[model samples]
Target: MSTHPQSQRRLHAKGFYDEFPRKGGTASRATHYCAGCGHGLLHKLIAEAMHDFGLQDRAILISPVGCAVFGYYYFDCGNVQAAHGRAPAVGAALARCLPEAVVLSYQGDGDLGSIGLNQTLQAANRGERMAVFFVNNAVYGMTGGQMAPTTLAGQKTVTTPNGRDVETTGHPLHLCELINTLPAPVYIERCLLTTPANIQKARRAVRKAMEIQRDRRGYAFVEFLSPCPTNLHLSPLDAAKFVDEEMAREFPPGCLRDRTAEVAARPAPPPLEPLTPADIEAVLDKCVAVPAPPGLDPDFGTIRIKMAGFGGQGVLSYGMMVAGAGLADGRHVSWFPSYGPEQRGGTANCSAVISGSAIGSPVLSHLQVLVAFNQPALDRFARDVEADGLILYDSCLAEKPTTTTARALGVPASRLAIEAGLPKAANTAMLAALACSGACRVASERFSDMLAQTFAGKPALIAANRRVFAAATEWCQANLRPE
Candidate 1:
């Protein structure tokens, strides 16, 4: 008689990926976590909970910039790898956007307690609908064995050579205690994974947190007091003992807050309603009719403009005026500004795109019209203009560009603004010159209208800007040709 084969009892979660492969096409069944590390155990617990709750399909896991960064490779559910300490913020946003989806933020002690402390705190205080799993290993494990915020007072790390200095670094932050003070979070608990019994308790906490998310409840946090054997310079057994004894003495493993009984499940958000073409047209029709220049090429699909100057020279404002004019003309527009470190002395630039059709990208590599408000601005952006493009430079700048294949026009913007008794209206003068020279597709009258709208709050300056604009337009008409 043939013997019946015994079935294997599967312990691994079906939510985990079949295998984690290296970039070079090699598949490895083993994880990168060190032996006796708590990450593998924690990952298993969370994955199993997700599998049991049937949340794998609706789950979105946000992994922080630490050892858990490779969570995207293992978790079969949706994964978003966030910047250091920003997992909570990202998870909160994902939860809000996908109200029905279960969002999980997985972070290490350094990522959550150090640089990302503010983000984590704010998310918990807001009672965002999500689950946060914090693994407190008391050391920065990914970059190096550097001192983490949760590093024990006498613990030795790369930064804390002899031991942690409480006077200078302060005591290890009790995250659950701090977060518990907030009124928003529905559940806040701390658990350990050192012993088998502790592991069972931790697994239950993980499942409970996931269950709250499945029920569409408010914020829930579970911190795992885990072991770092390699960094702690101890064997697996010794590390487990350290977590159970010394670490637990500082960070007692138990529930700090549990309001699940009092809290009600949040209602499911309304489904998104699609808009028809007529609805979109009704919205677009509200734009003011700013006429284009006469005899402008109807085939002109898009125009790319780049404006650059010193930060205080209103470089961003000039680009905004151009974009505003395009919008007033019922055209699609985008304005992107780039500023250096200091807002005042730093270099500032902006790219404005006006398109008859949908604007695909705000970034511009080559410019159709380049406006430079100073010598530095001219020198920096002259090479980026197209061969047949137009370059409008301030006449006060002595440095003339010679490398560009574009046609260059010099405008006395500063002198003209001063002549109009408004030294700050230099950018307005350049806008007028751009219209008068016919380098831009928009009509000169449309630019004047935008100037009126821009300075509407300061009615006294509107008259001075219009005068400066007229003067610059006259100068451009006489001196420059319409290409």
Candidate 2:
């Protein structure tokens, strides 16, 4: 045996975790990719580059929904798994918000080229400072062997068993060529992973992209012609041979555009200053016309309310009025609206949450109060009211809705609004009923101020709504039992 010193063996990259406990199996040291997959090799190249650059602390990897979706399990940096086709948008947000972050978006051909094509192009067009690594394996390797946007013209996939027909499916998308047409991208390249020399070239391309990110240079995209042996129904060697011969012919590997030397580094954005209480008060004073009530209680607990009706019935407006009143009472409030496509004839609904403490979410599943403007609204949402809660519906509804758990009341809101000389003020009447019945904890006297603030520029509507509110309150007091 020769006495020469043996070359030092390479260890795992420091950018990765010592152990992937998230995998939850004995094979924690291995990735989830199939045997002889190119993803493992590409991941190593990226992690090694990150480690060398000392960017492991500032790097944030946005993983997409594909075989590599488990990237968070291996990468030791900040990891966020975005929804399928939304990685580019998420990456853009992180780049803008965290200027010091080295944002990296990892996506497969199916995720980036198909559903996420628009997002990818838009982000590139805006010249977002990030690095995007796109893997084009010809076919959808993760979800069975389906045809992808990068699949060759005559490639045979499960969806295209007879080979992709250009007549029906159109021509395959040349993504690098498409991106090269844009002016904002600073670098665009395509590399291969078939041979050892080609793999080294791909490593150079990966390192170059990360260097661009380190300098805060605008948009760098690197596409890799990778192998997928299991999906292609071929041995590892045959798959690499296929990529070397057929795939390379379709997507030639080389740099299409490189302006890294010409582009200057972007300046880091100033840190965001936290808003002070006085700053918040100043903004609220300008936005909110009605001042919060003096000496208001801050520990009123929480109350949830839902309002539903036809689109033209102002159901969403009623929910907003309640939310606005809660705000004026010095409580935390949230109003969320849901409506159909049609402007006037479709169904509409909204949820309102009022609390003295912090509100976690604006969505409400169960309600302390349900206000329905029509029979359909009552039938659909009456059962969602709590057992000790209250249900109020328009008296004009065709039939009275029965509820076994909660007390029910029929308010002549429409008639009262008409009598008060404005049919559009019916929403104000509903608000008055809710306040007078004690269903919501807000003071009834605050509705007049809320209406004044809501119609700040329009004086006539404010007077009309106040009349409707008074009529509804008086009617409820005389006829409906508070119990």
Per-prediction TM-score = 0.56, 0.57
lDDT of candidate model 1 versus the reference: 0.86
Cα deviation in Å at residue 429, candidate 1?
59
- Candidate lDDT scores, in order, read 0.86, 0.85
RMSD of each: 15.4, 16.1
User: Judged by lDDT against the true structure, how good is candidate 2?
Assistant: 0.85
| Clash count, one per candidate | 0, 0
Find the 10 residues in a row with the least total lDDT in model 2.
1-10
For residues 456-476, what per-residue lDDT tens digits would candidate 2 score against the true structure? Answer: 899888888888988999999
